[model samples]
Target: MYDAVEALEGRQFDVVYTGKGALCYLPDFAQWADVVHQLLKPGGSLYIVEFHPLLNAMGSVALPGDTDDLIIRNDYLEGRGAIAHDTTVTYTGDQIPGRQRSFEWMHSLGEVVTTLAATGFQITRLRESEVLQWPRFNGMHQTPKGWWRLPDEAPRIPLLYALLATKSD
Candidate 1:
């Protein structure tokens, strides 16, 4: 963990991409922002494409019988700190022998933007999409382009979000 920042000591990058389910595992955005800032040169940019908090709060589940039901099973915003999960099964259908424990924290859009702004990064763009990379919910359909989206009859909800931030030159 400590070597992450050290790995890019004097090097600078034009762009950094972070995404999917990555943010939840990070307990400290300030430290993350600092590392990003250090690794980037002036005028560099950071692009993030991640799962929306609303989708995360809903808690993706396999609803084979009832595909239309949308439920909020978890907190939408950060309240009691990190949420802990202990399970043997992985998302990829793999079962481990030993105990598997993980911690995740939900971050609101406001918090995400403010953290980057506070770290001196300028927000360039923000986009929320109804399409997802995978069928997060049952009855999702795959488009010809390979993206998954809800049918026209289903309510439009943001399943993913992307944000671009740039450092001052």
Candidate 2:
């Protein structure tokens, strides 16, 4: 993103959209916000629809465990830098021929909002949803829209979130 900002050479856009777990791959929210700000024209908007951080706190779903209840197995507020991941299979239970190593950083919703606000973005919309595109846990149920969510008796938590912020004019 920083490279794109530089490569654009003063070019600005009417909107910038990012989502679907993209923020986790980024190490610095402040730097990202700076790049977004530079890329957008005055009054342009940045829209993000991503997996909620609460899902991160649940740890890896691939691990062997009973899904009878939700558990907090990881940190919600990330102060610990990058988390390393090594996996040989995809989330859909497909096996990979070789292990893949990756690093990700957790950014709380507060951090995301603060970074954008500090970067001169006026937050316009923030929405959290309990539905997910896939059934992340065994206890999840398919919604009418074909999305997945916890059963009615289960606690309602945010699985996804969408935020919209506009650059200050």
Candidate number with greatest lDDT: 2
Per-residue CA lDDT of model 1 for 73-132, tens digit only, reads 888887678988899987665999987998999988888999899998999999999998
* Candidate 2: tens digits of C-alpha lDDT, residues 1-169: 6688778888999999996979988888888899999999999999999999998887434556644577886777768999887899865578998998778798899998988999999999999999999988777889888999988998888999999999996
Q: Which stretches of candidate 2 lie over 4 Å from their true place?
A: 60-67, 91-94
- In the predicted model 1, the residue pairs found to clash are none
Per-model TM values vs. the true structure: 0.87, 0.91
Candidate 1: C-alpha lDDT:
0.85
TM value for model 2? 0.91
Show the lowest summed lDDT stretch of 10 residues, model 1: 59-68
The number of clashing residue pairs in model 2 is 0
After superposing candidate 1 on the true structure, give the runs of residues whose Cα lies further than 4 Å from its correct spot. 1-3, 60-68
C-alpha positional error of residue 65 in candidate 2 after TM-score superposition, expressed in Å: 8.3
